[model samples]
Target: MAEQALANLHTDSGMHGRKAERFAVNRASRILSINPALSGISIRSCHLLDISRVGATISLVTTIGLSDHYYLNIMGTANRIGCAEIYRNGSRVGVKFIKEIDDELLHTIVRGDFFTAAI
Candidate 1:
């Protein structure tokens, strides 16, 4: 369980050049470290900057050369948000989901909660 809410990414404004609106989520999450697909890399800690149904913004110390694919594991449940890198800005990154989240999950995050179930 290593996913934070999206309101903590220090972004009040929406992501640049994105069609969807991104909501800020200030919560804690962990990057999966032991994936065989991502060898030679350890788990990195990051914060959820913002999120939408299609994508999310994350803040990390360094996002250089990170795999284009990620499994954004949720903190409290057996859920993971699969995504692919879309853009990068120093320590921040924009990602597009492999599968979009549903309206229910959106409500949970906006209400100050994590995505507890797989969407």
Candidate 2:
């Protein structure tokens, strides 16, 4: 089942029993230009279902045309984290961050302190 797969991806031990702790963020954000050279990098809206220092689970309307690597722009901040696709099921995607984010930034995102822009 889809729910089971998602749970497997988001377990406290994480996708493969990794160390970083994940937070249930459910924050709105965007995928910035999956392939810039192909179409000048179009923005696609998505939601951060949860996040950790090393990766995140995202939900979008569709996964069509999404790339293996891209940047995730958190809605309320100027931060952009490089991501590499790990898995996909229906509207949900699992990605591993190219570089782990700092704890302060992770806390800020989890606390909803970033400046979110109008849709």
Candidate 3:
């Protein structure tokens, strides 16, 4: 039987350095990457390793080798979750989900061009 294909994401502090300083959670809100639809010009599924309202770390495996770039559909919302490059071995590829619990900036990134998944 062929191996099933799916993906996941994970995240935490220190994933990104100065670029990812903690934002104040004054009026806290939860950010989730749902709507991983298999549509759109560039989109793929990933294993969500970890995530905060902001962003997440994720893992994906492809029988074919990975390209330096790709987009992530966070499995629920129409929003296309962003991703940055990460290590890869054989069919396994890793990336950081780009978004946060914060609303404005998060919307900005997703609303604009897709960026590398920062960690």
Candidate 4:
């Protein structure tokens, strides 16, 4: 629906005609928090089905509507600022990634590391 450039050009023969690969990790997720700057602030704990650089697909026990707007502080990453529009499929909610997960937390999450993290 939109004209996108995709990614930057590396300008090398091996790298020239290629694009970047994205990583997606899927799991059950609970709503940690939201950004103070955004409106339409309705979210809750749900089963996060899939995750990628673009966004996340989730199942909300309740309905939260969709829009390409809002700031989400996913997993308590301060540098992580982005918007997620709620897309419903049966009981699932789809959210697109608008920010990058911070390095330390992202590392821990990718490693499947869990501790009694005090919120």
Against the true structure, whose TM-score is highest?
A: 2
Q: What TM-score does candidate 3 get on C-alpha atoms?
A: 0.39
Ranking of all candidate structures by their TM-score, best first? 2, 1, 4, 3
Give per-model TM-scores: 0.67, 0.77, 0.39, 0.46
Candidate 2 residues lying further than 4 Å off, grouped into runs, are 1-18, 34-39, 113-119
Error of 3 at 33 (Å): 17
Give the per-residue lDDT digits (tens) of candidate 3, residues 27-95: 111222333373435334555443345444455445243445455554434555565556665544445
lDDT of 4 by residue, 11-119 (tens): 2122346432223333345554434565435555565444444455566666644335544444433433364665667776666556544555554443341231111
How many backbone clashes does every candidate have?
10, 1, 35, 2
- What are the candidates' C-alpha RMSDs? 7.4, 6.3, 13.2, 10.4
TM-score of 1: 0.67
lDDT of 1 at 49: 65
lDDT of each: 0.66, 0.78, 0.41, 0.45
Looking at model 4, the pairs that clash are 54-97, 55-97
Q: How would you order the candidates by lDDT, starting with the best? A: 2, 1, 4, 3
TM-score of 4: 0.46
Better of 1 and 2 by lDDT: 2
Error of 3 at 113 (Å): 26
